[model samples]
Target: MDTVRETTSAIKLLEQENIPYTLHSYPTENGPVAAVDVAAYFGYAPERLFKTLVTSDHKGGYYVFCLPAEKRMDLKKAASVVGVKNLQMLKPEIFEELTGYTHGGCSPFGLRTKLPIYVDHSANNWDAIYVSGGKVGYLVEVQPKVLENLVDAQYAEFTK
Candidate 1:
């Protein structure tokens, strides 16, 4: 397959590792689309899509969470899992500053820094998951284990 820079760093890494993947992009309207929308348009199950969320511990430490699209992350539980006393989401500008990606384009694949990555245990239940390709209207489908392995993420109870 032809490699493209539109993908996240993680996707690039997958390419470098010779992992097979397929990239998908669609019409975007500059807003968060329901996971069901992606599934409906892409012809995949909603359960097979993950969303990348950028959050922080009150101490100014930012981290990323890759969770199933159907579930929401429990901030309290995430803070406890990461051993942080307080957890909150960073401001939109802060996220752009830290991750070098816009709100809708954030992908856990490659970031400006190696932020702690937490993948919900539910992700392991799926063989392939579709994640953002560092831009709105773009996504990449890859093996779930490959994503976790590339990011060196910890498996945790990240969803509500």
Candidate 2:
């Protein structure tokens, strides 16, 4: 089994809580890589891999949403779930600035601050799911409940 000795804040917190998880590493590609691509690279179903998205309401409140790699977030549903009139995806620059992790590396686990997180209901069907490991080219496999508890996230139908 592959293990990472270096600790990211996300990994450290998981370890401290004794949550069971597995670390996965992949070679970095030359250009942008999508979550679906990562899933394919790891030989996992796209639905088992999730992408963490940061969004902001018109009032400037930040929220996080996790959905299957192959699905698109339903903006209207996402806004409704968060009780906002509207939501816009946070710009890459703003996301990195606020979360301290780049676009492809954002994990709900160890953000600079605690933001409300909403995971798509579909994830509940899986025993475990994969999410970014706070960096590009790395992923963490963890039980959905473990991830939900770690981030205080709620699950809802927020994907199209």
Candidate 3:
């Protein structure tokens, strides 16, 4: 369905930016939906569906990474990409307070705080990609260029 499951700051920001997008809502009755399942529902390769991951540098600074849902983040590469000696996933409990979004529901847009966002370079292989609609069970599909432009995200190779 093209209907948004709900309006979020992320969606609002897209509307404000005039970026074209489509919304897809997946069933969440079974709790958080796996990224693969979401991709399968739309008959897309996992690489086309990116998941937002949050990390913290040893120095307490936070960063966001977006990679294919099925791929793994190489800590060394991730740390280097973010210019950190040590990179750790932010604890699930801290996601909401720190980013104004819950675990598995954070998007690169409309964050509570400004954070450097890095998206996997693989995203460019797709004409468009899906990201959390700022909430679980909802996704927004938009051109990767537009997504990167709107969020000021850097494209990098951080996947293993």
Task: Estimate TM-scores for all models.
Answer: 0.88, 0.94, 0.94
lDDT of each: 0.79, 0.87, 0.87
- Superposed by TM-score, candidate 3 places the C-alpha of residue 153 at a distance from the truth, in angstroms, of 0.3
Lowest summed lDDT across 10 adjacent residues in model 3 is found at: 1-10
Instruction: Give, for candidate 1, the lowest lDDT window spanning 10 residues.
Output: 1-10
Among all windows of 10 consecutive residues in model 2, the one with the lowest summed lDDT is 1-10
Q: Which of the two, 1 or 3, has more TM-score?
A: 3
| Deviating ranges (above 4 Å) for candidate 2 | 1-5
Ranking by TM-score: 3, 2, 1
Cα misplacement distance, residue 122 of candidate 2 (Å)? 1.0
Stronger candidate by lDDT (1 vs 2): 2
The digit string of per-residue lDDT tens for model 2 on 39-158 reads: 998889999999999999888899999999999999999999989899999977788888878888888788888899999888889999998888887789999997678889999998
Per-residue error for 78 in candidate 1, Å, reads 0.7
Which ranges of candidate 1 are over 4 A from the true structure? Answer: 1-10, 30-32
